[model samples]
Each structure stands twice: as structure tokens, then as C-alpha cells.
Target: MSPRSCWIGSALAVVALAGCNNVSNEMVKMPPPAVTVAQPVEREIVHQLEFTGNTRATEAVDVRARVNGYLQKIDFEDGADVQAGDVLFVIEPAPFEAALDAAKAAQQKAEATLALANADLARTQPLVQRGASTEQELDVKKADVATAAADVASAKAALTQAELNLSYTQVKSPISGRVSRHMVDIGNLVQAEQTTLTRVEAFDPIHAYFAISESDVVELMAKSPGTSAASLKANPPTIYVGLTGEKGYPHEGKLDFAEAGIDPQSGTQMRRGIFPNADKLLVPGMFVRVRLPVGSPAPGLMVPDRAIGMDQSGEYVLVVNEKDTVERRSVKLGLRVNGMRVVNEGLEVGEWIVINGLQRARPGAPVKPERTTEIVEAKQLDASNDPAIANSGAQLSTTTPAKASATGGN
Candidate 1:
């Protein structure tokens, strides 16, 4: 090797060694992650299950024509409230009146004939006993009397039928309710037992029908052993109902009816609830929200839904320990009351849980946690989450019982 090149390489190695010695290994401390935390709320809570249902009338009646006649008059206004036995329509009474009169005349004639025949039989009996008439003649006279008596009875029945037809000419509301519009106008020919003049539905008490899944039914039956859907029909459970667009269940009702069995097509069992609608606020066929209590009141712990998290292990929540270190806790969950998810296990009532900035939390890491009495501040879905699932269950339920409803029975 050339002496100049060896000297240059040696100089470069000495410089690199000096640079390496000058550098020192040191670790920079990163700041603890800032987060919000809250203690869980403990309360005696029962599972409130809500289901979509439809309102029904307690008693719905289709006022139909009872006798064939021309509609003569409409006595009640369309959609007016009516009492039981209130006249709503008037068919032409002329024909029925004439028929009834004819029947009465025929009955009178039969009565006169029966009286004459009775006198003749009395005379024949005396004559037969005294041998003033032949036995065959007396027998013939007795038969005549019997025939006349039968005619009189038949005529009386005809008269009663005629009177009934005349009475039916004035059609009356058979139920107390708001009447529907007239189906047939004045002078329209209506057939007996064939035409529906209008309809009436009882309004004081309304009904709501709903369905529940088989799993829910099983859970409910387990909580109250020996309870069956049929037994519930006899003595209903407490329930609540709400109309569409209502914020919460505003109407109270009772669960009175349940289908004999579950519907195979939908895997749900039909149930019914009855609500007092004295104010006439409820209508038939309206969609309603029904809420039912699945379990008796028991102590339970709840946390903000946002604080709950999921991982390969299962659902978890970040809890802050005494040292304010973030700890991942696996928890068993119950039904959501609203925004709050009930923690059945793995969480204590007083434990601090991370309510916000979950991304910043990691197990065993120290964190800057701000504690507040308000456990779950109502929160919306974050933008980074998948849109489809991001909006799902974002808000936490405020502290309240879950709303529910069901059907009604007699």
C-alpha cells in the first residue's frame, strides 16, 4: 500500500472513533396521556324491554243493516260520538209498518176463529156425552178446534217477527264509541245482514299489541319461575306505552294477552296491553312503543357506554386505580337502559372509569384523569369511527328506568 493512502485511512478511523465517543445514550420522558374518568353509579334496576307495537280498539263493531230497506235518514253526523242504543240511521219504515199491521190483522182473525172453534168443541163434548151427536162428528169438531188453535199461535209469531222488523228500521248504535262515516246514503237500498252501514270502536280503553323474541321470553320466565304467557293473560303485568314521536313512555297499561304460542315465522310471541284512553287520545292501528320489565328490581352498576371498549379478549373498560394508572377490566354487560350500559360484573360502584379519550389509555400507564360526579356526559359518535357502526349506541342513557308496554285482557 502507498504510505499517503494508509495515513488518510488511519486519520478517518480516528475521527469516527472520536465522534462515537462524543455521543451519549439518554431517554426522553413523554408526557402522561390526558383523559376523563368517572365512578360508576349503583342503583336498584330492573330490565326494561321496549318493543314496537300497534294500538287496537277494545271493542270494534261494524254496524250492519238488519232488515232490507231503503235508507230513509242518517240520524248522526259522520264521526260523532254515540252512546249505546242511540239511533244512527233510519230505514224506510212504511213497508215494515204495513207488514206489521197485516200480521196483527191476521192474528186477530185467527184469534176470532180460535174462539169460535173452542165454543164448537165445548158444544161437541156435551153432545158426545149426551149421545146427541155421533162420536165421529165430535172427533171431527175437536180436530177443527186444534187446527184453529195452531193457526192462532202461528199468527202471533208472525206478528212478533213483523214488529221486530219494524223496530230494526231505525238502526241504532250498539256500542258507545265514535262512529265512522255512513257507508250508505239516504235512499240507498241496503240488504239485511249484507250491508255495513258504519262502524264503532270503544274509545275509553285502548289496546296495544306487541311481540317479543323467544330469548327474551326465556329470560323473563327464568326470572319469575312458574310464570307463563297464558298466566300473564289472566293477570297482566305492569307496562308502559308511548306513541310514535313521543320522547318516553307517557301512557300506562297492563299486559293482559299473550298468544298461545310463538310465531314460527318471526320467532316472536304476540302479547297485548290495555291502556285507559279516556281522553280519546289513542286511535286504533296506531304504532306504539311498549315497555316491559323483565326482572325484579335488583342492585346493579352502570357506566357511560363510551367508556366500554372491546378487544380480542371480550368487552372491557379502562379503570383508573388508586395510582391513577389505566387498567383494562373485562366486564359482563346487561341490557342498556338508554345510554348507560349495565355492568353485571367486573366493575365496582366506586371504581373510576375512563369516560373519554380512550385512545390515549393503555394498561399500566399513568394518566391525567379528571374525576366528576357526572358519570356519562351525553356524547355523540366520533368521526373516525366507521359510519355504519359509529352512530350505533353512541349516546348514554340518562339515569332512568327503561320504558316498556304490552297487551290487555278482560
Candidate 2:
């Protein structure tokens, strides 16, 4: 081949190889990695402190016979609900009835004597006016009438006492509550206010008693003050409560009472929460958990818990910006609510956080952003539109509180 022709052919060959390499490079190039991102949502959150407590009854009464008598009948079932004034025990009324009859007889005798005195006084008044009877005799007649009148009054008082004793024979419950087992059985002699027949405890609108440390009280006083404020008795702070076997504080109550001062020995102020027990689930002496707000509810930024990452430094989350680059943000986390975590510091509302595909997302790497909110809205729509799924979801777990209120002591 001629020299010029050979050089031209080599150049053409090099150009062909470069074109192949260019095609290979074009085929190998990839689009940015797809990632799901969500903005930090604003929610109302209250900072809270948790304390352990136990349930208590608002009122308890011990039932006893008010009149001395032999117990004739037990009227209520042991460990059963009883209303106020319900008959709990029936003491024998025969003795009381006899006493009442004797009193009535005595009153009748007094009345007959009084009537006789009045007749005599009437006769003496005419005689004295006519000067036929002496004044001294008339004075003695008046004195006798007065004595008889006093006797009638005494008899009437005795009758009232006897009636009261008779009524006391029917033992009644003092308050509406559940009665305990009988302490005194039928056929036993029961003394008035001495022998206890049974005991009862009020159930609904139960109370939970807990204690807050002196430091906690001081902190609360400076912040919300609650019932610990200057007007302590009138305004009580709000509280959340949960019993054993509960997921969280499903019950809300108010701080009803606080000790006048902190206990010297324990350095804690005894506090009580009054909760409406409409379901009758809470009973006396039950152990409970309570959450008291340290501060008022305020708007805060929140994100899904899965988006949070932990390392040697602290908790952090990956945010995808408008430039499509991932950025690691160190976050000061507060409490967990629902399935989200509150970012107390270092995160701004509307910042796009990578919710899924965390493995593929790296700091400073570009990502193809997918709006997680859209996905959630779509899921919610599906839940509302599909009757079968809606029914099934209704059968799913009931709506639970998004946040956990209890915490370890500081």
C-alpha cells in the first residue's frame, strides 16, 4: 500500500475504535438513584414527664349496725354493686318495736294526765274568779298543770328516740360502691357503731395517686405551674394516664390535689389525678403510669422514625435538597409520637427527608426524589375508597396514641 494511503487507513481505524468506546460509555451511563423523601411536618407537641402511681378510691365506708340488735338477715350479695341507702343488713326489729310501743303507752298516759290537769285548772279558774276557791289552792292547781305539761313533752321526746332506734335496725349503705364480704354474719349480736358488717369502696371516677419530686415541682412551677401555682386548689394541670396492660396513656385526667408542701423524708409532693372511669376499668389500689406536661403544647417539626439514623455522634437524618443531593443533618430528638419522632432542634419544617432506600442514599450523592407524602395520601385514599379494606382495617388494632409519655427518671 502507498504510505499516504496506509496513514489514512490507520487514522480511520483509530476513529472507529473511539466511536465504539463512545457508544459503550453512553450505554453504561445511569440516571440518578430514586429515593422517597418527606418534608418535616409541623405538629402540636407537649413536653412531658412521667411518674409511677397507684389507683385509689375517692371514698370508702365501713358499714355497721347503728342500733344494738341481733343480725336477722344479710340483704346484699358479697362483692356486689350497691347503691347509696341500699339495705345491707337487717337487724332484728322486735326489741325496737317493743320499746317504741312502751314509749307510745307512756306518751298516752302523760296525755291523759295533762287532760285531767286542764279540766281541774278550768274548774279552779271559775272558782277563783268567784272568790269561792282560795288563791293558794289555785296556785297549786296551776303548778300541777305545768308539771303535767312538762311530762307530756318528755314523753314525746322519748317516742322520737324510740322511733329513731327502730329505723336504725335496718342497716343501710352510706355510699354507692361495691361491698366486701360480710364481717358479721346473721344471728350474731351487733352493737351500734361497734361491729362492722362490711366495707364498701366507691368505683367510678377513680383517683390515681402519684408523687412528684421537689425539683420537678420547681421546674413545673416555673413553666406551667399547674395545680402547684399560687391558686393551688382551684386550677389543676392536665395529666395522661395508663393502667397495667395498656399500650399508653389512654386515659386523661386532671391534677386534683397536691400536698401542701413536699414531704420532708421523701422530698416529693404527693399528687393525685382524678379520672372519669366510665368503663369502670380502674379500681382502687391498681398500679398506674402517668404523664404530666412539663410545658404547654407547641408546634414542632416531626419526621418518620425510620428516617432517623444513629452513629457515634448522635441521631441524624438524610435530607434531599432541591439540588437532589443528600445531606446528613444532626437532630436533637424529643419524643416519639404515633410512628413519628419529634425533632426538637436542627431540623426545619418542609425539609425533604429520605424515608426509604436509605442504603442507596449517601451523603453528597444525587438522588431522584419521590414525594413520600403523595404515597401516603394515595394509601389513605385507597383506605377510604375500598370498602373491604376499610372494614378489615376497622377490625385491625384500634387507633392508638402516637407518642409514648412515660420515661425514665432524670
Candidate 3:
């Protein structure tokens, strides 16, 4: 019980207490693991194909001068809408008029010579018949008459040609359409069938040319009969065209032509749609989107686009198995419908997928599942909702009212 013994005992007790504290700190409890959640979703997805196409006019005609002359006047304004047979240009008619007059004068001279020959033949015919003239004299007279008749016929042909040349001075439009800028100014000498006066394009029933892959054609034809282009007229597919910035479909069209053969380089088939452009909104060479419904709708698996993630590898989605374990799955995607993606492979219907909190989830980790907010019926989701569907469903709900109410109404 001395002071040194008491200090040593106090030091040992302090060391033992410190050691126990260190052991307790080393054995501290661990925190709980993070959990991810999966969602059971139902959405209608569409498989669509997109292609780039160009707008074209159904019929484009170039206006050219058929006769040689100076352009006297342009009857139609540049870019003005015109009808077929409308006069477009007028060449200087003075030259053509002069030629026509010369032809007419020649025709009159030929007619005078023909009249003289006929008179002479009448005078000699009776003499030869009454034996008052030699046979050689009658033959000579006949020859003279035939030669005069030939000259008259030649003059008549020349006159007709001259008249036709005169009419060519006034050029007219070949098709009903908007005319392009005048290629020749006034007093510009134009040649016969050589100069391009202007251009005219038919706007209504415009053409939309688009290409589809051969595979797409085969798939489409599998569903429809008369696969050949010649036979497609009976039941051709409808086409829809939309401008670059337009929201809704502006024009509806019909499939007018399909190429007889596929393009060797692109392995695609060229098809044209005829759109009724009464307003002339669609023009040639304008870029547009051409939509053609090629096949029927079918049931397909889909997942929310938000669930899809992309990295160095490609597109992937997080899937939750029945054990509530998350797994990263690589998926092949089709078209996008609503906000969901059509799954071509790598996933099945009725499987749980992780849509929300994808960044926080990892593969092989346990998660808690919750239902998604948006759920669309399988059959209700098509290219677009058909109003007939709602009508049919409502028709099924129609029934007789209560018996008392029915009797009172009657």
C-alpha cells in the first residue's frame, strides 16, 4: 500500500481501459447496402422504318421555241400559274407574215396556171375527138395540162407550209402549271427547236420519290398480293408527306409507281407517290419525309427509353430477375413508340426492367421493385389510336336502363 504501488496499479488499469476502447472501435457495425428498384411496365410499341426522300413534280416540261425568230413579247409573267394551251410567248410576226403572203401569192399564181391548162385541154379535147387534131397534138396538150397541175399542187403545199410556219410565232404552254423565269429577253433571236424559253411544272398531284430497301419490299409484299409493280394499281398503298418543319401531315398521296428493278448499287427500290397539291405547297427538289404504311401492326416487347443507357459498348438496359437482382442486358432496338423503345431481341415480354434510378443501380445487386406510372394496354397501342376502337368498346357497354325508367320513357 505504498505511493509507488498505487501509481503502478492506476497506470495498468488505464492501459487496460484504453485497449478495450480500441477493440470496441475496431468492431464497429457496418452500414446497410444500397438497393435498386425494378418496375413492371406495359406499353404499346411500334416498329417503324425511316428513309430520306425528295419531292418531285409529276410532270415537268421545258418550254422551247419551235421556230426561229426574235422574241417580240412574253405573254405570261415569270412564276405565274398558267393553264394548258395558254399563250406564253410571241415572236416577231412580221417575218412570218411576209413569208405567208409570199406563199399565198405563189398559190394564186399556180391556180391561174391550172385554170389556163384546163381551158386549153377543153379546147383540144373535142378537136382530137372529132379528128380535126393529130394524136401527137392531143398528147402534147395532155402533157401540158399534167405539168400545169403538178405546178399548182406544188404551190399549194408551199402555201400550207408557210401558213404553219406563221402560226408557230405564237408559242403556247404545253402543260397547266407555274412557269419558270423567261430564258430569253425581248429581241433575242431564237432558233427552231434549239432555245429553251422557260420551264413549266405541274404542281397538283405532285410526285414524291422515295427509296426502300429490297428487304422492306419483300416483307411488305409478303402481306399483300400482286407483288409486281404492274399489279399494284388495284390495291396501292397510301403515302403521306410532311414538310421539313411542319408538325402534322400536310398532304396525303397514293403510290403511283414502283421501279421495275432494284438499284444495284444501293440495293434499294425506288417508289413514287402522287400527292394532290391543289395549294401548290409542295415544289420540286424540296426535301420531305415520305411515310408509307408497309405492313400490319404486331405485338412487340418494349421498355421505357429512360431505362436505356449507352456507353462504349452500345445500348444496354438494366433488367431485374424474379430474385430481385439487377443485370445489365444488351438489347437490339427497333423503332421508338411514345416514350418507349421496341425491343427486337435480348428481352422478353412480362419481364421486370429498371426504369428509374438506373444510375444508382449495378449488375447483380438486390433491388426493391415498384410499378411504373404509365401503363398502356397492349392492343391499344398502334401506329395511332383508331376512333373506331373506342366506338366499338362503347357499343359493348350499351344496355337497357332500369325497367321502371324504360317503361316511363316508352
Residue-wise lDDT of candidate 3 within 107-137, one digit each (tens)? 8988898888888888988998899998888
Weakest 10 consecutive residues, lDDT, candidate 3?
A: 401-410
Candidate 2, residues 14-35, lDDT tens digits: the string is: 9999988876444565776887
Candidate 1 per-residue lDDT, tens place, 68-167, comes to 9999999999999999999999999999999999999999999999999989988888888988899999888888889999999999999999999999
- Model 1 CA lDDT for position 349: 59
Model 1 alpha-carbon drift over 4 Å, by segment: 1-33, 233-235, 264-266, 305-318, 321-333, 356-366, 375-410
Name the lDDT of candidate 1.
0.80
Residue 113 displacement (Å), model 1:
1.0
Candidate number that wins on lDDT, 2 or 3: 2
Give the best candidate by TM-score: 3
TM-score for model 1?
0.76
Output the lDDT of residue 136, model 2. Answer: 95
Instruction: Please identify model 2 stretches exceeding 4 Å from their true place.
Output: 1-44, 229-236, 299-410
- What are the Cα lDDT values of the candidates? 0.80, 0.79, 0.72
